[model samples]
Target: MQFEPGDRRRVLPRHLRPAPAPEVFAYAIRPARPADLPHVREIYNHFVSNSAVTLDERRSTIPSWREKYALLDRLGLPFLVAVSPSGAVLGYAVAQPWAGKNAYRYTVEDSIYLGPGAGGKGLGSALLQALIEACEQRGIREMVAVISDRGAEASIRLHEKLGFVEAGRMGRVGHKFGRDLGTVYLRRALRPSRPRRGALFGRSR
Candidate 1:
């Protein structure tokens, strides 16, 4: 089966949907919508301004993020969000091309972020796991995470717990927050027991 452009169906399979959040934080994880972009941008821009988790020097605007979100939709990639029962966005995760060239079509890069009040509550894990499962369903073979070296042990450990392995580390490759920063690259393989079927990257069979 194939998904058409702009399909609003859930990106993850039923089996991959995360279990209910703890009573203290009831939330649902689902594919992103245009209305969610403002909250998503808020979470991401927080990282952009306060941490090295993302390398963006300038904060992202909603308009730019909208373009990115649409591109991912056209590419059939997953961009998911965790939303509270009250409609607050707790976190988001996305899968993008590892490289722009066609040779890297089978590989993707993942980015995950949570709101300041949402960490250590299992939201990140749940979001990333769903993203992984969605990519697997789409016939992707590998997922890579590029993490900042400073204060990144938690991020590294989170990825490791999810079965990703340290692939490489680029030393002092980025300058941010008035200091040189390094980056850690982690990768996870997603090939399943049965060979994948259907089209990838929006290519028809």
Candidate 2:
């Protein structure tokens, strides 16, 4: 995909524009790198400071963010980012093990975050679809998304578009900023992959 300079959020960085332009908004979903932390954190902090997308209000530093990637990498989890032709990060997506038991090994929890300017575009869906592909490649069978109340509609709509169904809704489960937030669980079952021969190692596996 190719994005014109004016179409993307920020000035395209030289390294990020690895391709030519296309008719649609030019953006690509790629494996996230440690060097992309700053741009990723900027978008994430926007959600943290201004919205209930995340329960955390504390700001994230590069070190803390890197720690998260390290943990995910160690667990063979998926962490991806959406970047424009100019290198601006438009969004990020990830999946984490859903539970600690062996029975839960095939299930994973997923999340998607888009930068402020990237909303309303196909970016969110692209990020999610990429995450879904990553999970499918890794043999993940079920994926769950716990969405904040305010994001329920958009999240549900996206998940539905990707074949997810509403699993449950928990009322007043989390309090952030100054209001109570409801959590909605959306799930999608993926095709099975090669079975593991033995138990996997990890606290959340």
Best by TM-score: 1
The most accurate candidate by lDDT is 1
lDDT of each: 0.85, 0.80
Per-residue lDDT of model 2, residues 117-154, tens digit only: 67787777777877887787778999998888775578
Candidate 2 has an lDDT of 0.80
Candidate 2 ranges beyond 4 A from true positions: 1-24, 194-205
Off by over 4 Å in 1: 1-23, 192-205
Q: List the residue pairs that clash in candidate 1.
A: none
lDDT by residue for model 1 (1-205), tens: 7779997776788889898865566667788899999999999999998888888899999999999999999988889888887788888899999878999998999999999888887777788888888898778899999999997678898999999999999999999888999999999999633334342111011
Task: Name the 10 consecutive residues with the lowest summed lDDT in model 2.
Answer: 196-205
Q: Count the backbone clashes (under 3 Å) in each candidate.
A: 0, 4
RMSD of 2: 11.4
